[model samples]
Structures are given as C-alpha cells and as structure tokens.
Target: MSLIDELVALHGVFAAGEYSYRGDRFSYKGHVSEEHARMASIMCRATSMGVHMQADIMAGSYPECGVAPAGGWVVRGPQFTVCVMANVFCFLDNQASLNAVMSILRTRLADASSDLI
Candidate 1:
C-alpha cells in the first residue's frame, strides 16, 4: 500500500495526505473528501511556511535557540490532532498514535524537500 494509505490504516488515524510546498498538488486517502483534502493542502502549506518563517526569525534573533530547520508541527484538538512532517499530514483520533505516525513519517520522508519556494 501507499504511504498515505498505510498511515490511514494505522490505529486512530482517520485521514492522511501529502501536499506540495506550493499547495498546488496533493493526494489523500481515508475519510476526507477531495475538496477537504485540497483545502487541507493549502492550509498545511501555509502553516508550514509560517512555522519556518518563525523558526528563521528565532534563529536570527537568538543564535543559541535551536529553532531553525523545523522538523514538523502538530495541532491538537479535542477530537483529533493533525500532525505534519515534511509535506505529509496525518489526522489522528487519539494522541497515542502521534509517536508511531511521526516515526514512520520521519523515516520514510526524511529526504522530502521543505523548500518554501
């Protein structure tokens, strides 16, 4: 199965996807609709860019602060949590699944480019 498929199949993961840095391309599987996936891609790209920008500013202002080279981000909600690594996004129902999903994403997508442009 594909990586997104594999992630969606994992326990507590209801949806998973991959999006381009530009937010123009994406693919997803599981309970999400196509339109939702597209919007998610755009949101993910914007959020990732925002994080990178914050990290850049932090690194420049505080050299000792190791916020540069952002690894990923997470949005925890009452019902679900969205975990993003590289360009991949996973919507998990339980926080318990975060570690496993992040481990897989970090290993498999280690080479993924995070360039903003």
Candidate 2:
C-alpha cells in the first residue's frame, strides 16, 4: 500500500500527507482539506524549528551533547491531535492513542523508504 494510505489506515489517523517545510502540499490522502493540511504543515514546521533551536541552545551549554533535537512532534488539542515529521503529517482524534499510532506510522514509513523524517 501507499505511504499515505498506510498512514490513514492507522487507528486514529484521519488525514495524512507529504508537504514541504514551507507548508506546500506535495500530496495527501484521507479526509482533510488542502487548507487544513497546509495549516498543519506550517504549524509543524514552526514547531520543529523551535525544537531544533532549543536543542542548539542546550547543546551549546554541554561539553558533549549526546542527544539531538526531536525531528517531529504531536500537537494535541481538545478535538484533534497532529503528528508531524520532517516532511509528513497525520491527524488523529484520539490523543490517548498517540504513542501506538506514531509507532505504527514510523515503522510503516521507515519500511516504505519514504522521507517521513
């Protein structure tokens, strides 16, 4: 199955896509509108940048930084949750299931050799 298709098949995934770091849509699958996907993409990119910046600051303080910054994040709201990677995002309604869902997505995307990170 296709990457987006596999992502959408996850238990709580309602929308999934491949988008640029600047929020331009390359492709998408599932029920989300183009506008929503782009919005999520933009948010993800911003958050990712913030995370890396923080990591950089922390690294500067340490003589030997062993851990790197997170490449992705999950944004949880009352209504939905968004999972974002370097070039992909997925929407889910159940925050309680986030860990499992992300694990599945990560494994699937890795196996498929897609640029999800």
Query: Against the true structure, whose lDDT is highest?
Result: 1
**Candidate 1 per-residue C-alpha lDDT over 1-117 given as tens digits, one digit per residue, 9 for 90 to 100:** 788988988998988998877667898987888999888888888899889889889988998897677778999889889989888898889655788998988888887765765
Q: Supply candidate 2's per-residue lDDT for 77.
A: 87
Best by the TM-score measure:
1
On residues 1-117, what C-alpha lDDT tens digit does candidate 2 reach at each position?
Answer: 876787788777888887665454557787878777667667776776787677667778983885344456678888898887656778888743788667866776554322323
Clashing pairs in 1: none
**What TM-score, computed on C-alpha atoms, does each candidate reach?**
0.89, 0.75
- Model 2 compared with the native: what TM-score? 0.75
Runs of candidate 1 with Cα error greater than 4 angstroms are none
